[model samples]
Target: MDTGVAIFPTHDAIAPADVARLAEQRGHESLFFPEHTHIPASRATPWPGGRPLPRRYAHTFDLFVAVTAAVTATTRLRVGSGVCLVIQRDPIITAKEVASVDVLSGGRFEFGVGAGWNREEMANHGTDPRVRMAIMRERVEAMKAIWTSEEASYAGSHVSFDRIWSWPKPAQRPHPPVLVGGDGPGVLDRVLAFGDAWIPNHAPAGILERAKELRARADRAVGLIVMGVPADPRVLEAYAAAGFARAVHWLPSAQRGPVERAFDAFEAAVAEFTGE
Candidate 1:
């Protein structure tokens, strides 16, 4: 499987430009930075990973700005938002940002998006957590329209607009690839409906089987991108054998020393797995 890296990109972490430069220099294929506009202190919603939430979640830089810095620092390394919280964002502006980055990076932008989990966070953005999936779908559909048409418009329950002109259409033809992120019930339906690719956090059991089933049931060929991959050759080999298109390893938010150490280890694992 092709190997990429994902980072939280906090203020205290290594600069995104440096991280991207190092990733490309080490032969990594891509760099993804995740987003969280702001983490509410209400503590109404528990952390997705359970227990104390990481400090980086609250301190992460704007995903677009971080990704722009990263992509600007490297020519070959693809940079993207690991998963933008589309349910909380305006689709029109998001489409413009996606197209801008795609154009600026020579079509090296991948749009990974999710509905998100934090109920309070969604509420803060004026989105209802219960209906977030529907909202996310509408927003994604709207963005697609903006990216592909001369005078774009969308009519949906959550998102609607009249014919509006949007320029700088994406460099990647119709649009950048939309990689939907999640592994919850009904997620496969979402992936088949709008996503060009599926990104599921790597799970220990039944994931490869699930991937196979998804491929079997899909109407057209779909891409599988496994995220949160550990630096393990055997696991990566299993992913490649299961026909996964790519695997993204997490780079912890830290200073350059720890970040590079992790990169070295991950690169070694990748080289071993690929027999390079």
Candidate 2:
């Protein structure tokens, strides 16, 4: 499996530009940044990673800005949002951002998207957590329209526009690949609906079985990218055997020394898988 890294790019972390340079220098295929406009202090929605939410979640730099910095700092390394919260963002603005980055980076952009888990955080953006899935679908559909059409238009329950002209159409024809991110019961349905690939967090059991099932269900070849995967050759070999395209290892939000140390360990894990 191709290897990549994802990080929560906070103020205290290694700069995204440096991270990108290092990742590219180390011959990693991609780098991704997670997003959260601002974490609500309400503490209403439990963090998916469980309690004592990491400070990085709240301190992360703007996803697009971090993405842009990373892309600008590397020529071959693909960079993307680990998963942008489409439910909390404006589709038109997001489409423009996506296209601009893809254009500027010579099409080395992966668009990973999802409906996030923080209820209070979503609500802060005027999103109802209950209907976020529907909202995410419509926004993604709208973005796709903007990227592909001369005069784009979309009419949906959550996103609507008419004959809007958008420029600098992405370098990648038909737009950048959308990697759908989630592991809910309905995630595969979402992937089939609008995504070119599926990105599920690494889970110990039944994931390869699920990947096989997803392949069986797809009429087209659908990519599988496992996120938050550990630095384990056995697990990565299993993923490769199951036809997963990539495995993304996470880096802690920290300064250069800690970040590079963690990254080197991940690289070693990947080297074993690649037999390099």
Runs in model 1 deviating more than 4 A are none
Worst 10 residues of 2 by lDDT: 42-51
Cα error, residue 200 of model 1, in Å, equals 0.9
Model 1's alpha-carbon lDDT is 0.92
State, as a TM-score between 0 and 1, how close model 2 is to the true structure.
0.98
Give stretches of model 2 more than 4 Å off.
none
lDDT of 1 at 172: 95
lDDT of each: 0.92, 0.91
Against the correct fold, how does model 1 do in TM-score?
Answer: 0.98
